[model samples]
Target: MASIAMLVFGGNAHAEGGSYNVDDASVVGAGKCQLESWLREWSHGSNGLYAVPACGAGPVEFGVTLNTGHGVYGPGVNPSIKWQLRNGDDKGIGVAVATAATWIHGRQDDAQAYVATTFGIDDARRLMVALNAGVDRIHGESTHSLLGLGMDVALTTRWTLLVERMWTHRTITDQGGIRLAFGESSLDLVVGSERSPHPSHWINLGWNAAF
Candidate 1:
């Protein structure tokens, strides 16, 4: 249960700016700040609240996530950093590396790291695709490889569609959502399902802002 949230929301992208599960490249320009918050309800009698606040400095972004609620084993904390390697102009391939450590009840529980790639499909910047692959190192469990693929489409200035499917050898998760913008802030309504700890479905209401 905890692994699903961490990988789905915090691992590569960690709610990377907009889309839910797909890790997007850094967009927080130097000296800028942003906040992300979400309220989630699961079909199997569980719910949670999450908050992520982040800032940018040069090519790197620093952030942390606060998770709280039920049905989740470790609603701990995740502190992470991401570095943009190089921005691709001609091929539209942008790359980044993100790493984070999780602590539950004051004890380190797990660590995650991922290399993410974003590919632009058009010049208008209306559509984008992302790929993330990483390693999950739990305190007492054997390490596992994590991988995910996602895509987002901008239907208009105020509307965007997001879809993602991420997995490892043992778990699979799928998310679909719509983003509605209000100036520098946006709201999202997402539906998701995961195949771990039992088959579960959830809905999330998320809001993001840049400052």
Candidate 2:
């Protein structure tokens, strides 16, 4: 019952931008239910789940994120699914690969797929950053390309931070935002803002739980 509720409210069931409410509930497991309600108002309005194997044999990590936003399809919202892989030194030097798909629903429902790669950097302290670039294809129209860059900084062992910006030739589509994470698995706070050239800007705040 609780898991189902979190999935509905925390998954950006009704969002308009590429970001989701701050406390992106999906990141937490099943033990932090107490913080869900408040988190609905404090996050970036995007949900992402990631897994990193205990850096051992060869420094490999992978993760995924679901983005809820509007796109080439129409006024309806779309879901963007992504898979990422990283390989390099424990200090954070290496290459990262990512591929994502978005399904747009409505009049003419269109789907898009994107693939990108990034270079990683790690100061090893509390700050880290990565860069990515890729191309996007819209089923029937010309293939639209994109160049994106982002950074992640861990303020502490339990607090993670994110900043991302992307540019494209199309109007009313460029976007970016920031995210902050706190706690381990059950409690957290997130704040973020995003914009599009149509030109609208939105702010989000959320608190989340996983029990």
Candidate 3:
């Protein structure tokens, strides 16, 4: 449980501008859940488990944001790994791959890993194109698959924009969001929706800082 929280928090940290440097790659992310009801936590000893079991690895540093219309919870950890193919001058490029997984109340939950191929022009203007694919086991009885493609743009040194569309093999998802960096700290907001077979939405908001 503690480890799971740590991973989430770590992702949040990187998103918050903690400076994730991996083989020349630096990453930042922020967003909000489209719906609030889907984001629920386990009650102590109430879920018939010691804690939600989870484990993952990535850049060793990350940041996250969870947002609700009523309030916000943020700067969480995440599991991610980033590799920089080129890091210098105004032109830079890299590839980052990461995944974070957890089981809520033994319901068997998991999040797929994403691979982002990013390129930047003039250092401040960043463009990222990526894909996500993963599977989840639910209720010890069923398994679900996820696939997605997304893009991100840095408006400036302090602002970023992102848009994505995903499919769970069983459902469709639409994600749109933005990010802001304040010196050593950062914040993010994102909105998501299910568009194909049904109608649903979620939002996420997060904040984090460097060590």
The candidate scoring highest on lDDT is 1
Model 2 CA deviation exceeding 4 Å by range: 1-89, 106-122, 171-183, 186-197, 206-211
lDDT of each: 0.72, 0.31, 0.37
Candidate 2 positional error at 7, Å: 21
Cα lDDT tens digits for candidate 2, 14-69 = 00111321111012111221222222232433333311111111222122222233
Off by over 4 Å in 3: 1-93, 96-99, 111-116, 121-125, 133-145, 196-198
> Model 2, residue 152: what's the lDDT?
48
Model 2: how far is 137 from its true place, Å? 2.4
Name the candidate that leads on TM-score.
1
Error of 2 at 36 (Å): 12
- Decide which is better by lDDT, 1 or 3: 1
Q: TM-score-based ranking, best first?
A: 1, 3, 2
Q: Alpha carbon lDDT of residue 169, candidate 3?
A: 42
Question: Cα lDDT of model 1 overall?
Answer: 0.72
The local distance difference test score of model 3 is 0.37
TM-score: model 3 vs. ground truth? 0.51
Error of 3 at 150 (Å): 2.1
